[model samples]
Target: MANDDGMTYADAPLRLGRSLDIATNRYQVSGAIRSVGANASLPTDTTDVLLETGLPAVDADEVTVGDQLRIGGQTVATVETINAHATRDPNQHRVLVGLTLATISDGDTTRFGVTPVRRGNTLSLATDEYELDGRIQRVGTLEPPGTPTIRTVTLEISEVREDFAETFHAGMTERADDETIARVTNVDVEPSTLITTGDDGSVNVVDHPINRDVTLTTDLQVREATTGTTFKGRSLQQGSTVVLDLGTTTIEATVVNADA
Candidate 1:
């Protein structure tokens, strides 16, 4: 990693883009692990590569203050602040990724990142960004919960979707009780996002909108005659999949008609 000669971090020996990897030495800040580097593409808002893995566990206790971390043989970042519920445990955790620069010398460097993992008193650092998701299988008759189930059979996809939101919605089957009732589950919605699936196979998404179809009807009744949400000549039914306006958003209903 090389920077212009004029710049300097005399106080902190760190910057971004400096090949920081797993097992790399780390500097601690606020009880969290962190490294400093310099990269033009790094814009704290939405970096293409988030060194913090997919999402941290939403466990407040798990995030140790004054802990150290690294990736790919190098130190990457330290836990600056945690912006989540402390008392409540969320399904996914988002950490604020900040490069630790004691001075300006560590800037303009290319480096790898590492994550801290602990299981039953065993703590190790990892150098991979991993995510959890799912696949689909076609199934029979619709009447699904809301989001389509992964199709288990052919010609009838179960409408597989990655559905993992919060834990409070774990055992709640309100959708199964009444088809007319509109229920919302806040969770991650794609294979890239973590989908909460128990052994029995249930799914829910976090903070997503329902049936925002330009071609589909707001009433959410699947029929050729239905006007608004008509995709592929058919209105959406429970457990059905339709490409919503170039496939930006996905809307799958559990039953054919919520009103029915």
Candidate 2:
């Protein structure tokens, strides 16, 4: 009988029987048939794709390894690894998600929420528990982290206390949790200039200096990761601010220069 495709199936069983006979004869000539084990397993199909989201770090932190991903109530993949990086916005983070493939239908697109899982596709990531809506900034294998190295960074603390500025010196260490992460190699202090604006919005610098500003040259050990070179979860780059904890006090300083 022919179906809608106009293909006859009346002799399909006979054809299958003949094909099985041919295979049996070949196997017999070669050797005894190997018994198939019930517990035999096939190789798993997995793809490492980058998933980006604008979710806050707190929410992004929820997507850990070994998490299951599903769409339309069907399991599609498993989370293998995750890395979170802060964006320009202090409140938002972009996350990388590595996924292990599962049951995905042909031509059926997988989506993180309503966003399709396509390269450069911007969408939010959603699971049964958390709905993290954002964009997929990248798609490919995750790059390995680079080796850690000691990098020189220049930081400036404006309008610092006179006593602290006078006592600040090289060999001072920046500590976090009682561990030193950076050491000051050089310290430069200059009189902080006082500026005033005129009625016409013109700026004027006063000759008299009131406060002191200290520029600190420090060496910080850092590693180049997918996000960037980070120390204590903060990116160490020009224009970024890092808080240094001295034994006596803590000071927030803006990075003016950073070594590549």
TM-score between model 1 and native: 0.20
Q: Which run of 10 residues does model 2 get worst, by summed lDDT?
A: 13-22
TM-score of each: 0.20, 0.47
- The RMSD of every model to the true structure, in order and in angstroms, is 19.5, 13.0
- Residue 161 of model 2, lDDT score: 66
**Which candidate leads the pack in TM-score?**
2
Best by lDDT: 2
Tens digit of per-residue lDDT, candidate 1, span 1-260: 23454333433334433332234255532222144334333223211121222244533335443343464454433343222211112344333222231111213432222221111111123223422121111111111123322221101112243232222221222221123211222222222223466677878544324222111122222233324333222344455543211112233333333233
Candidate 2 per-residue lDDT, tens place, 1-260, comes to: 55454333334422212322224432432222222233533333344565545567577767777888676576666777665544445455556566654522223555433244577765444586676454444444533245567888999988866776898899988543234678999999988888899999999987335578899999986677777887544577889987665656566789999863
